[model samples]
Target: MPPPHSLLQLIWLASPALPVGGFSYSEGIEAAVEWTGLDSEANAAEWLSDQLHLSFARGDLALAAQAITAWRAGDAQRIRTLNDWVLHTRESAEFLLQTEQMGRSFVEWLKLHHADTAEVFAGLPATYPVAFAFAASRTGASVHDGCLAFAFGWAENMVAAAVKAVPLGQSAGQRILARLANEIPAAVDRAMQLTDDERQAFAPLLAVLSARHETQYSRLFRS
Candidate 1:
């Protein structure tokens, strides 16, 4: 088990109340709702579930796992490589902005508690996952627990987005959140099992939707 203080830190990091601007972006979920009419409770749950298993698990989750290892080892080069992958692999301008904006915000938040964070990430364009990994590395939690925290943070943010975009009630949102909670461990397992060679960020449909979302007629979320 992780240390008590570390566990608390993880919970804090996972909280939606963190000032990371995670609530502003729906990660193309709003666009999915607009373009694909993904409005029902069942469809939203399935959509988010598929995204968790397909796109997120294969991409950012895996990247964060590797990045946590790199941060722990003080491997600046590996961290750079991972950050570069995030920058280049973003499917759309909004997606790119979401990661970069949230990453910068998270770093600034870290600076309030950890003085050296600014210097440590001085020259690097740290993406969300990489910056988050750095914070996780500072905790006494194991890599697995850190990743769980990261994934749950993401799931909470996405579910909130779904609640608004799908127009679901609180109870429906809780059901979706419960479903995602059950699936997170398995998703994390797959993310951790991936090799650098096997890591990928290829979700063509999501990319297309995100691109279309940039010009979406009406929208509530940023991406």
Candidate 2:
């Protein structure tokens, strides 16, 4: 088990109000809604679930898990490699912007709490997962638990996006959150089990929609 204070820190890191501008991005969900007509409650829930498993779990979640280990070990080379991978694999402009902007924001927030943060990421273009891993490493949580926090944070943000883009009621949002909550542990398990070579970022549909969202006539979220 994690120490009590560490557990609390993890919860805090997972909060939507952490001020990393996460609430401003729907991570392609807005595009999915507009382009694919993902309007109904069931469709929204299913969309998020598939995203949780197919795209997020395999990509950022696994990367963050690896990055947590690297940060704890002070492996600067590994960290840089991971960060570069995230930057290069971004499928669209919006996707790239979302990761880079949130990463910069998260690092800035961390500097307020941990003075060394700015120095640590000085010359690197940290992606969101990599920056988040640095914060999570300080919490002394196991990689699995750190990933749980990460995934839940993502789930909350995406569900919020679905609520706004789908125009669903609060109850529907809660239901989607509940479903994601139940599935997060399993996704984290898979993520934690991934080897460095196995991590990948391949969500073609999400990429296409995100590109479309860049030019979307009306928008509620950044990506």
Candidate topping TM-score: 1
- The Cα error of candidate 2 at residue 158, in Å, is 0.3
TM-score of 2: 0.98
- The worst-scoring run of ten residues by lDDT in candidate 2 lies at 26-35
lDDT of 2 by residue, 77-180 (tens): 99999999999999999889989999999998998999898789989988999999999999989999999999999999999988999889999999999999
Model 2 Cα shift for residue 182 (angstroms): 0.6
Alpha carbon deviation, residue 114, candidate 1 (Å): 0.8
What ranges in model 1 sit over 4 Å off? none
- Provide the overall lDDT of each model, using Cα atoms, as 2-decimal numbers: 0.93, 0.93
TM-score versus the correct structure, for each prediction: 0.98, 0.98
Cα lDDT of model 2 overall?
Answer: 0.93
Instruction: Report clash pairs, candidate 2.
Output: 28-223
Cα lDDT of model 1 overall? 0.93
